[model samples]
Target: MTRRVPFAWFARNILVGTLLGGAYGAIHDQVSWSISPEYFTKFKFEQFAWAEIGLEPRLAASWIGFLATWWAGAIAAYAVCRMAFRHAFQDGASSWPLGRVVRRLLAVLMVAMAGGGCGFAYARMRAQDVERLWGGWRTYAGVQDLEAFATVGSIHNFGYAGALLGIVLVAVHIKVKGRVDRSSPQSLPPPGR
Candidate 1:
């Protein structure tokens, strides 16, 4: 039988996922800002200073990036959790400790890797735009190369952060909710049960 998952379960997962994702994005931005204030300052100046935009615009840009990353992480987490829960319900494998753990871990890793890849692609595109606009890294921001920043700085950093945060938040939700119960009339038992 197909068991209907509760709306509360989805609500909880999505809420926690969004909060964790946003937190990760904020932390990443703050840490990056702190680590290389000069780079950020110069980059911001070059990007927005000539546009007559003030600090508010810069802050808004950071927030936009944060919100984008947060939504990406949230969607990834929600999708993974929903799929895992459905799989468990279908196979009655939720009781299998090792199996469940492994499945969840795999899901988390997949989400992380996907996020990283997408981030890399986005960074590459942005790098291209920057190069085209400024005639290369040296002319743009006095940096020798932006390839590293595009790949490692953007992809690896955001990907790992999102994955780590997603896993932790999802695990906490699972723990709090306990096993998926099928005893209620609103639920259904596993096939052949």
Candidate 2:
């Protein structure tokens, strides 16, 4: 039998995931900028307006990219969590023992990591293609530079970290709920007559 989670709980998870994702996106973009300002500048110039190249435009593009990935990561994490919970419920594991919860959260983290790795690979390939098409307009320091920036700047890192944080938050929530449930009048001894 499947147990339904309260709507409030579900909504809270989604909101938390969204905020974490946005934070990750913003930080990752900044780090990427710091590591290779030229690459980002070139990428933004190519993607946006080639003639209008400036720091402000690059920063604006970064912001847009961050917001886009943030929403995407948040939605993805929320969906995965909802599915995980539903599967657990179907398997009659709604009680959420610490071990079970950890395992589930780990599974989510792995998914995020794998997704990030695949995304990095795809982006790298696309960047290379763009470079080739444009007759190598931008000069890359080396392959390692691209790899480093892609891995570090990717939203996957944020997703993984966010998932870990989400797990901890959920665990704490469960513990607090357990305590409240246990201390409720239903569990407490009846009043002395």
The residue pairs in collision within model 2 are: none
Q: How accurate is candidate 1 locally (lDDT)?
A: 0.55
Model 2: per-residue lDDT, tens digit, 19-135?
555654556566556655544555544554533435584465466445645564456445545554653343333344335443444454455555555656655666655444433
- TM-scores for the candidates: 0.46, 0.45
Local accuracy by lDDT, each model: 0.55, 0.52
Provide the lDDT at 179 for model 2. 62
Q: What is candidate 1's lDDT per residue for 84-173, written digit by digit as tens?
A: 465445444334333444455456656666666676677767776755543455565665444543444566465776586657655655
Candidate 1 structure, TM-score to reference: 0.46
Which regions of candidate 1 fall more than 4 Å away from where they truly are?
Answer: 38-65, 90-135, 140-193
Task: Give the range where candidate 1 is weakest over 10 consecutive residues by summed lDDT.
Answer: 90-99
Runs with alpha carbons beyond 4 Å of true place in candidate 2: 1-5, 42-62, 90-193
102 Cα displacement, candidate 2 (Å): 9.5
Q: After superposition, how far is residue 26 of candidate 1 from its true place, in Å?
A: 1.0
